[model samples]
Target: MDLKLQKFLESTDFIRAVKVTVAAATPVILFSYLNLFSIGFTVALGALFTFSSDIPGNLRHRVNGMLASNLIATGSTVVISLATINPWIFYPVLISLVFFLSMIAVYGQRATLVSFSGLLAMSLSFSHSYTGWALLQHAGLMISGGLFYLCISMIFYYIRPYRYAELRMAECIVLTSKYLKLRGTLWDIRADRNKITEELLSLQIELNETHEKLRETLIKNRTKGGSSNQNRRLLIAHIELVEILELAMATSFDHNKLHHTFQEHPYVLNAYKHLAYNLAALLNELGQSIENRKKYTGKHRPFQDLEAFRKAIDRYEKQTHTSGRPTADEVLVLINMFNYVEKQAEKIKVVEYTFTHALHTQEPKHKDKELEKLLTPVHYNPITITQNLSFSSTIFRHSLRLTLTVLAGFLIGNILPIQNTYWILLTIVVIMRPGYGLTKQRSVHRTIGTLAGGIIAFGIISVVHNSTVLGILAMTCMVLGFSFIQRNYSIGATFITLYVIFVYGMLTPDIQDVILFRIADTLIGTALAFTANHFLWPSWEFLSLPTFLENSIKATRDYIREISVFYNRKGEVPLPYRIARKHAFIEIGNLMASFQRMTQEPKSRQKQLGQYYALVVLNHTLLTSAASMGSFIQSRKTTKASEAFNAITGAIINNLENAMELLKEEKQNIPVDKETKEMLKLRFTELKEIRKKEILESGGTQNENFRLKMEEGQLIIEHLIGLTNLSENIVKAVKDIRERQ
Candidate 1:
């Protein structure tokens, strides 16, 4: 088998797809018995509705978005049909609805846009031919079809809740392990930065999607019994593991200067390899645990093994200290890494405890505080809602653009004495978008898709005409083709275009130049979309990206401070700790995305360019250090050491606060106290020495050992350098800006 096929087979995602497909078809199949026409309309409407929910953002957002889009589409269709009589008034109303609906469809609620758009199209298409009662009847039939589909999906969800959760968890674990392994090899890959960046971004996206899938399953199984509870715990554990894995990857990259040393040191390299393997094994075990939760009614054995692994990890840390005289910084790094792994292990332990209790008890005990601390919030801020509404607002702007473009196309077609004005309108509606890039991409795909679709449609009509059976078969093929297209943008569009052409051909038996007309209309629509997106109060991506990066940087600084404070107190940080962590992670993600967008923009903004680069570097450094610190805090076994570490953290927090304020205010700040500096210098130096000794003991070469020591030494120098530069630059920048103001 080809690689693609192998991957597809391995994914087992097809199983879920099959389940969804069946659920979707069920409503149509059932409704077909009641009314074929209703079934046909409902299936099309359902297909369109499916688009409304297939967004790539947070689940909560997608759900809310779907609801909003549906309301707009259905409500608009009903209101417009009843509210107006004159074709001129009705046409403008339709156009207005399309504009608003399209804007929402593109920017705000991506998942539901198609259904909303379809609702407008459907109302316009049938209203003139059908009267008030008939239109209401059709609407009722469509709604019933949708509800039926949703019910079937709900039934499937409940039947094997654990199955989806387990599958998702397993996939997440596997992908995370692969990502970690890739991290170790990244320095040696020699790939272009863009390629590497894309790979890393893709990995992030995959991990996020996995988290979403697992979260959805966990929510569904919240009230389910022992097995479900156990699975949820496992999912939580998996999430922590993934987070750590991501941190590890980022840490490795930040310290890429030590790549050769890391590669040469048997122990360091072995640790990394072991970490990946162990994580992979743990993930596998978790998958099995979920699978066998029902079969084995006893306490989870993996938790016991997990505890042992934690102890073994602790021993490894001690061995590093014993084998060589590591520097203070190296020691800190090692300690942090050990702590992070242990915390992950501890999470698994807690999960096990919760699951075991849940299995034996009638009512599962609430561990709200514990779970709350574990999970991070992933919600849009209410304060930013109005500002962020730009995304939705753009949708409205684009819709108007499309409507104008369509009107122009219709007029031009009529002026040119074309027989089919509807053809021009259809083309305009399909092709027109709000922006240049999107318009270009859509046009290319639509044209390709239409050409292919038209050919296929023609062939089908020629092969199977006059028979209802053939017509049904053709429709089924079209639906399936559209489904396939849903998986890939380029391919899906082609199939959909073909499907549309074929359906039109079947509906109207002899139209010789219909396909040709479609191609022309698509091109015209594409042109209109491009024109509108570029000229209509064009929103430049560069503006959005910089602001986003700035916000992310601020969020990261806050997160660092929060974590430091939490460590200093040596107690559970409130919800804000988790919230900060989540926000920071998301911010970094946004920063990365912004950086990508910035690259696409014209580079005339030199000041912005410098700031962007500096911000990216700073963000990367912050993420690496934060991960190291987090790991150290979680891994410390001794109470005294923990307390000492906490004290050290307190001092760091004081310094960080002063530094951040200084940076913000652009003030010539007082340097940290001599005592604090001395302490930091001593700790970092000692940590470096410890790490060097470990490298030598691990049978690393003199060059490798020397490089490792230098790397550690360099980090201390870099840290100091960063602090001084940041403080100075902030003071200058803020002063300059204030003076100008």
Candidate 2:
């Protein structure tokens, strides 16, 4: 019951590890049963390498991708096997092939899988003597083993094709629920708001990632056109999740209100915390329901704390006169804020119910426009071979780094005094990454895992003499190791080490010989990887911050331009604008991630660390503000009376451009209208009367859309005001950092 061990057991990755373990073992088990144990080593390795490409995608895409991987692995192994006897001719050919494929990985994830798997196949397939036909036959076995894995993935897909997507979406719900609980801490002035902000940003990044995955799932299903009911239900549930996040961000709570009076008013703190916990409980159950794919139990009991929260808010309002601190409108804002919390908390049950109990109701056309967009496949241009070859790109550096390290490992592994030298090469491929910090962390984890796994494997082999049972154990270790590899590298490494030990033990009975040599090979390979990553075209976060920041600003500018286009004329919010928004969010997320990585490095390497914090926080705020504009613009009434107001969008866009240059510590002159803020305020005042008049003329009553427009519009205006100040702060922050440098 150790906390860390328990956490590992509880992880979803553990379940995935179990699945991968079986899938990887399938080929070995089959070859052994077929009395082909000699080729099982080569075949299982081929299958395990193919597992690298077994990423999440739709059924057709997944099957096709795996098939292509098998083909490449087969061809690469045949070539490597045939050429090994003539190193003068084959060695350079092999190195060139590795570099080319490694470069091809710049295209994307799928490309990387194909290229890297091929590299693995080639490196591991070398043999001293073999007829061309004999090499073909062994290569055929390896190819068949990979195909065997395809069957495993296809079977699981048929069982429940959407299970992976469901699990991912469920995780999103669970995370959002936890974040809501964290936000509920905002009411307590005693909370570390800075730490909370950091956590909130982290959650935002997670949600952004989930959004992309879910979008891909929706697109994949839509193209296939099967089981519309479930897909639609899942899509609708996802949309509800989006709204929940938007509402969570929409709260304009006065942090200063609690600053001076949090101690004086325990009721305020308790009520907010009470609601936060209630929300957390509700969403947690909803996550479980989605995961289980069964009837939602509606576990949190809606409005369980509503009455008490209401009373607390009322009490605070009544005592407002005594403190003379909070204005009347501020109290109303808190009251209004409660209404949002209530509605959003209640939405969990409603959304969950929609999944099971079909509800047919009329909604605005814009209601499902987002779902439509999510269903459409994303437009992307793969990296051309030419672009990938460019030395300036990160992809090129990674490709070069990997190619050299692999070649070095290949040479050292061949020259070493070891029986199973391929283990050394395998460790190198699995442990090294594009980033120095990441590679270092992985090497440490791999070393620890190997020693522990070696001990475990040694103990098992010492007791068990039967090769059949030992083979099964080795296969099991393969499954567990591959599963946890990405999730917990050390654990995965440990299991992988055991797998190597037992797998070879089954082939040849010298346990001590295999274990000692495998450990030494691993040590040698990992050290080579470490040395190569540091010395070869090293790209650190701090060094590239300027480029990343500039790209982020450009993306932000595009997003703002798209928003303006939406304002000028709109028809369900153009797809281009939505795509722009997506890229904007993604790029900023990347920037924040890079800055986080920078913080983990040595102090001398991250000299601009302070400026990075300021810049990143402002970047986040800018995105949120644009998001607010998006939420409101869909319903806001724009007319010729305020056509001139679109000019303000131009002004803001100019400011963003200026900020981009300023972020690079470059001097630039961009005129800013000192009257821009005042002009927008005056225009908003004019538009307010016009909006109210239209609302009255249309129905003489405030509809939900109108209410949303009113609330969201004010939020948009406030956020814009915040954006201008944040822009000014960013300029000063960059200037100060430059001076210090």
Q: Which lDDT values do the candidates have, in the order given?
A: 0.52, 0.70
Q: Write the per-residue lDDT of candidate 1 for residues 1-741, one digit (tens) a residue.
A: 664564443333444344345545555556566767445555546434543343433334444554444445455556566545566686677666655555445333353354445544433443244358876765665455445444544465457545555556656656665665455455443646555545665566567656655654454344233334456565555556545654564354344544443343435534544554555455445444443333324333444544554555455446656778454445445444454455554554453344345544332446533443434444435443344345445554555566666557656776875655555565556555544445556667767776776676667667666645544654555555545644655566665566556555655756447766766666665666566666765555554554555566566567666755665556654557656665666666666665655564445522355555555555555555665444444443212223334444455445445544543435544454788657765765565565566555665333544444444344433443343344335434433433433
Off by over 4 Å in 1: 1-51, 54-71, 82-84, 102-129, 162-167, 187-198, 216-227, 230-234, 246-250, 253-365, 369-439, 459-476, 598-614, 637-741
What is the lDDT, from 0 to 100, of the residue 599 in candidate 1? 60
Candidate 2 TM-score, true structure as reference: 0.86
Count: clashes, candidate 1 = 31
Best-fitting candidate, measured by lDDT? 2
Q: Each model's number of backbone clashes?
A: 31, 1
RMSD of each: 7.9, 4.8
**Per-residue lDDT of candidate 2, residues 346-376 (tens digit):** 6666676766587565344453544455542
Cα TM-score per model? 0.70, 0.86
